[model samples]
Target: MSTQKPIRKAVFPVAGLGTRFLPATKAIPKELLPIVDRPLIQYAVDEAREAGIEQMIFVTGRGKTAIVEHFDIAYELETTMEERGKDLAVLDPTRATPGDIITVRQQVPLGLGHAIWCARAIVGDEPFAIMLPDELMVGEPGCMKQMVDAYEAVGGNLISVLEVPHDEVSSYGVIDPGEADGALTEVRGLVEKPPADEAPSNKIISGRYILQPEVMRTLETQGKGAGGEIQLTDAMARMIGTQPFHAVTFAGNRYDCGSKTGFVEATLALALERADMGSEIREIAQRLLRD
Candidate 1:
């Protein structure tokens, strides 16, 4: 969509300690947990690939090696499939082609900003995309693609904006809209995790982003903001007048796959959408809901 400054690289911040989903997450990285048939991080990677992202930069902590492996071809399985002449379609979507991925370690459990900063060498002076795997956005044209279209129109920094209920404002980075032209909004400012009643607006920032390289410099100085951790919003807020920042309200259904309820919803929704799983999923969902 953005022919001018086509986004080539994407940064995935997968270093957070998923303390919220403990025990199950004790041995496994939260990003590796399956949402329907594919892992949560796979959904993010697929979204990036669809949007023409060539270099996949993942900022992972310890025990996230599985994520790197997920994007690699299972040599043994692939050889078997080729020999048996199996419909390659059965292969997992998570397996990306060779040389498509690069990983950086976020040794400290700092925060999202720090995690992203870890990939500075890889991103190096270019407009890049950021996709949080926890936010599984489902739609016709994927969320990042929609943002790329909007970015082409207003080239600065673009972030996905969705209207959440007033009470839910505290759970997200809220935006103050300057001007609204359909789905695109001129972002006046952003406040991270403000109290529900103190929030400026109901519109919240989703995980999808198309950010300028300059913001990384701002992040370098941003020691902490809301939670005593390097805050990406803090840096983005500084780029207000300097860079043209806007919020794109894309048409999509987003699920918070980090939470149990949201994960279950995504599982059911994705399963029901699949041709093979639709009938059984519908029957099970209907029976469960009826009871």
Candidate 2:
């Protein structure tokens, strides 16, 4: 039997009140924001689906029900489309079979750690993946798929890491890398939002993580860290030495849709890739540049 434990469930912590996007986010969850035509949450869920995750555990907060509804059957809409012969294929991405998706309320906005901890009841004792919908990762095989492949080979915790500019390291949780062999880097330590100069390495932790269940137990008592919230990195940091910890360098572009700049960039980048609108969007960009 393969020593690697199967990662059947993926947790999506979408409870954060997206303050950065202001009035736009005041009504809609940030995860519902579009990257091209698809909502940001769709990308994350689609990535998890591609990675063979059978169940989606959404740690949601109030007003975040839309994220769950997005994956549900749109009976009226689908019936109308079918009756009109409008081709229901476009609605395919929005539908999820019953029992495949589940949600638990994170009634409070504690932190990412707390948001993840809220899903503990469903996670049980198996290894699971966490995908931050705000961090939209784009790759041919999908970021989660890449991590799943690595997890099967190593059979321990695996996090996606991206080599960013040193100056940008302080804004992220960076790894104290022990050794690197190709795309996999051994994680010695993790410092969340350290000063740029004090950072151990520029390889910052991205959104995707395949973590052991023990980390949930560690988070049960994890003290607040950085910005006075229960930081997930703090919990994962404490679990570093107890088991295998490594970072997989993501072979893809990561767009931080959590911020305005990153969100706009992601929108334009993905929009420019569309078959029907690529030329039109490019021309608009060219016109704006000329004016």
Candidate 3:
């Protein structure tokens, strides 16, 4: 067994007011929006479970109780379904071992970095994974699983990265890259939302991170940056030299469900892949195209 500290908990920052997805998100937390048969947050949580994360820490905000309830076992529904001979297995993904999942309220919408810092109490001193529910990463073994495997082999702060168009580099936290081999790239530094011409690299952080607990300390004093919010990239940048920082190239398709176009694309992509609905969805898409 590798001697590195095991990643047992995953922090999910779901407090964002999904203004990009409103007015549907008016009452519904954007994370609850469905992709096909599952909500956006469900895909993220499933990815965490795929990596053997034992505890889920959701840093929530006002009007986000629905997210917590989504993972809770429905006693009444299950009992009724049992009487009707319904397969209980469909709900298996919704269940988390009691006490294994918990929530902390991030009272203000400071930034991604601040939201993560809210989970510091639960995370304690152990290394943990962070998943942005808005980014839908699809693969056979899942994206976080790929990062955890790399984390086991190397041991330190790791972020999933993808090479985006240079024009889009200004929209994401990008890494100043160094030595690289295969999927691993040494993180020389990090820049959040830098202008394309100023960006050090085209590789952008793809919303999945395996970070050392020490990041919380850096974040505590981290002043607002890049859009006047405590940028996670800024804190991660501060710890790069002190800790072994690297980026893992995710071998998967990532859909940004946080945006309207990306949300539609994810729905169509996933819907058209389902065994039960693929053919019909394809036909519908074809007919719509002809129309």
Candidate 4:
């Protein structure tokens, strides 16, 4: 067997009360919001599956049952589609085998670290991936697959990063870059939401992460940082010098679907990329802009 354990499980922290898109989010979990034709969580799960993740561990809170039902087989819907002569291939990406998914409840509204900590039991002792449903990345090979390939070569904690404007650095966890190698950057340290002048680098963590199991232990005693809630960045920052920490620059377009602007942009961008509707959407877009 390979000395490095295979990353077979992915933890999805879906417990957040998406206050950003309220009203709509009041009833529906933000993860279920459709980007074009697929929900944001579907993209995350598909990306995880593409990266060879065998089990999906969802850290969910109240009002998130729709997410679980979305992945499970919809008997009536499937039967209706089949009888209506509709191809069920489109639903393939959302369907999961009975035991392939596992869910854990995060009783309170804590931070990202706390949500992930909820799934530590299911993750056990193996390295696992973390996929945030709100960050939708579109790329040729998929973001998680790219990180997995990098993990195979580097074999430690890896996170996907993208260059944001210096002024925008305060909005994300900025990376202090130490060395450069193609798309990989040696992460010297991480500064969570640093001031613009204090940011070490423009590269920001982009939600996809391949982390070692030891990070879970670190979170056990990690105190709340930055946002008054347990922040995953603070825990991972402690592991920097001890482990091989690297940031993989993603070669793709990422949409912050949690925001209104990014959500609209992602929907329009994806719709305009579809072969059947691209031309129509392009014309509509042009017409609207001209008016």
Best by lDDT: 3
- Where does model 2 exceed 4 Å of error? none
Candidate 3 lDDT over residue span 210-270, tens digit each: 9999999999988998678998888998898998999999998999998899999999999
| CA error at residue 14 for candidate 1, angstroms | 1.1
Q: What is the lDDT of candidate 1?
A: 0.88
* Residue-wise C-alpha lDDT for candidate 2, range 115-181, written one tens digit per residue: 9999998999999999999999999899999999888988789999999999999888899998888
Off by over 4 Å in 1: 1-3, 82-85
**TM-scores of all predicted structures:** 0.94, 0.97, 0.97, 0.97
Off by over 4 Å in 4: none
Candidate 1: how many backbone clashes? 0
Predicted candidate 1 versus true structure: per-residue lDDT over 1-291, tens digit per residue: 445577999999988778888988888899989987788988898888888888899898888888888777788988888899887775567667776788999998777888888999999999999999999999879999898888888899999989989999998898988989999999999998899989989999999989999988888888776677887888888999898989999799999988889988899889988998899989988898999
> TM-score of the candidate numbered 4?
0.97
Ranking by lDDT: 3, 4, 2, 1
- Ten residues in sequence with the least summed lDDT for candidate 3: 225-234
Q: How big is the positional error of residue 105 in model 4, measured in Å on the Cα after superposition?
A: 0.5
